[model samples]
Target: MKLPLAARVQEAGAALAAEASRFSGYGWMRGTSGNLSIVLDRDPLVLAVTASGLDKSELTDRDVVLIDADGEALDSDDPRPPSAEAGLHAHIAARTGAGAVFHVHAFDAVVAGHRWPGGVEIRDMEMLKGIGHRANDETVTIPVIANDQDMRVEAARFDEVYVAATAEVPEVPALIVANHGMYAWGADVAAARRHLEITEWLLRFAVATR
Candidate 1:
């Protein structure tokens, strides 16, 4: 359904806030650890993203800041700033055409990303089907990039890795950065949430099995 820009902003603001809170409750975003973003529209380069340092569990729609495509803060009543990972979010949307980007540091993803050595591959799991992969018979390779303190550098590294991973497994929907967190995206918000949920489940399973 088409919505006015203000309504769209509010809708995206609420959805992102709720998603952040849910992830917090799941222990993925504990201690203000994760960030989320949704595209308001492509043309004007508007995005609604979580403000930095806010406790995810109590995040409000007021905490979601609107930023331009280049990551500049747009004029808004909410004076809070976007998260440090704003660059990462913008990079993903630009590179992947993703409508929503969700990042979290669940124990499963952190442990798996660290222990998996080269990269984590999920094979022969029913949950693998959730990320739009064709079959469980094949391995969905999730590249685990080393985390960088400088997000700009990290974003560039992720861009390269994302391109390579997509080239390798075009259907794969997410990637993990070693010792950092996991990123999942999709054509829209609901699809992105499913991808994140399924990937987290698969990562937990892989870690538990090994």
Candidate 2:
């Protein structure tokens, strides 16, 4: 049976907190610079996003706030506001049907975005398989979109560059924001975390080699 919404929300919050803490420990979410979210419902598109301005490393299950498809906070007694990038998370979830989305300010991601403003391309690397790409004879571009303070503008920019996956090629499942950071998503929290890590590793390799 499906769990109650409240129960599901609590579970999502805990899962998000765990992932946030892991990323924070890696210094990817330094201070409150990054945000994470998980879909609590798909039909109405409810999400549990990390609260704004809190130390991600210290977050508990209660540290998240519920938001709708538009990133508007739902009616709740919780006084915390959702992350400023909650809308982008909502946009990604809506566009990709990803169950979880994570944004991080990893140094490598920023460097790679600046180095490859058009997009970061990877090919013939074993790590590529980590992101659903072939380990050889295939090149994939992780799209890079211009960053904007306005979430609407950012989402619009993403729409222009976003490419759907095809039968012959799997989507990279991540993108970089030029001069900003990276956003990675997947079917669930675990997959999102793996994509995030693998993409960051790939970026680090690209930056290091260049």
Candidate 3:
């Protein structure tokens, strides 16, 4: 039997908290710097997102808030505001049909975005396979957009740079905001986590080498 929407939301909250804790341990989500989200409904696009201003490492299962496709809070009783970047998460979900999205303030991601404002070009690395790219001669460009205080504007900037996956190339599952951080998505929470980790590792490698 399918779980009720309310139950699904609670389940998503717990799952997001666990993922948040993992990222926090890596120092990628220092203080309350990062956010994670899971899709709860696709028809109208509901999401369970981490609440604003909470320590990522200390999140409980109840720490999440429900938000709509426009990033507006759907649960009026919940006083917590969704993460400031929730709109970007929504846009990515709507655009890519991703089930989960993660954003982290990893040092290497910020550094690489600053160094490569256009986009980061990576090629011929075995780690590339982790992000669904070829491990041999294929080149993948992780899109980077300038940071904006307004997430709506930021989402627009993302749309300007996003490239759809072609038959010959898979879509880049991640993006970087200049001087800010990176956002990664996948079919589900675990896949999103893996993509985020692999993308961060690639950024670290790029920063170290360049």
Best by lDDT: 3
Among all windows of 10 consecutive residues in model 2, the one with the lowest summed lDDT is: 75-84
Candidate 2 lDDT by residue in tens digits, 1-210: 999988888898789889988999899999888999999888899899999999999988888898999898996777788888999999999999999999999999999999899998988899998999889999989899988989999899888888788899777799999988999999999899999999999999999997
- In angstroms, the error of model 3 at 130 is 1.0
Q: Residues 103-198, candidate 3: write the lDDT tens digits.
A: 999999999999999899999899998898898888899999999989999989988988777888789999999999999999999899999999
Q: In model 3, where do residues sit more than 4 Å from their true spots?
A: none
Which parts of model 1 have CA positions greater than 4 angstroms off?
76-78, 164-168
| Clashing pairs in model 2, backbone N/Cα/C closer than 3 A | none
Per-model CA lDDT versus the true structure = 0.83, 0.91, 0.92
Give the Å shift of residue 86 in candidate 3: 0.8
Compared with the true structure, what per-residue lDDT tens digits does model 1 show for residues 20-137? 8888888999988889999888886678888888888998776788887667678666677788878778878877888999999988998998998577987788777788775656
RMSD of each: 2.2, 1.0, 0.8
Ranking by lDDT: 3, 2, 1
CA shift at 8, candidate 2, in angstroms?
1.1
TM-score of each: 0.90, 0.97, 0.98
